[model samples]
Target: MMNFHFIWPLSGGLLIGLSAGLYLLLNGRIAGISGLTASALGWTSGGVSILGLGFIGGVLAGAAAVFALLGHAGLTITSSPILLVVGGLLVGFGTRLGSGCTSGHGVCGLARLSPRSMVATMTFMIVAAITVYVTRHLVGGF
Candidate 1:
């Protein structure tokens, strides 16, 4: 049997929701990491580019702080460098093609009850499940 730790997951979810809500309330932003990353890279055309960069910086800093405090015991990635790069590229492409990433569609969009987001989220979930099944069962497994 698998042991489930509920407190950490719940805490993480609450933090995510709170941050997304605050971002939306304060800056009228969706807190989508992919969109913000594009904007930070100067690919997005608008006045929010600077804010996007700041947000990205904040994300990095937060991650660094967490690692520094927590010591990264179970957070190590064993994937090959090439696989990681390819996976990142694929995810970026998918985010662009889908018009939004999970954070935007799954979290923020669902919160607002958007039909488009509902469809997108459903598609994302289905595809993710398929990918996991294929990778874990058909392939050697991740």
Candidate 2:
């Protein structure tokens, strides 16, 4: 018998990796969500990439499909609106500062064996662990 707990996450990871790989192979672009988003919004020099818009649309569509199927039963956000906003702002700033997000560095960059991505991913993991510990143990909340 197999433990079912890991199956869903494992499957999701495989799907993400496959999609990223396929997107790169087909488009000659790294599927970095932050960069794609910036390009789609015309923040980048190209004045809006169709491919970036398509990628964003696909992601939203996929999320909508999942919500339609699952009905948001297991989804919960315990954070306050202010905290969420602050977090979002921080993430955006960090993405700009780091030149990429986790999807870019962790998945695509790591796949390409980028040294910068390696260091970035390690920093991300360590910071994440520290954040989790502080929030769970020190600050005390889910």
Candidate 1 lDDT at 18 equals 91
Compute each candidate's TM-score over C-alphas: 0.86, 0.89
Positional deviation of residue 105's Cα in model 2 after best superposition, in angstroms: 0.5
Q: Which residue pairs does candidate 1 place in steric collision? A: none
True lDDT of residue 129, candidate 2:
95
Evaluated against the true structure, the overall lDDT of model 1 is 0.86
TM-score of 1: 0.86
lDDT score of residue 39 within candidate 1: 88
- For 1-142, candidate 1 gives per-residue lDDT tens digits of 8776677668778878998999999988788888988888888776458888887898788778767877884567877888889988988898999999999999999998999989999999999899889878999676
lDDT of 2 by residue, 107-128 (tens): 9999999999999999889988
| Pairs with backbone N, CA or C atoms under 3 Å apart (clashes), candidate 2 | none
Clashes of each: 0, 0
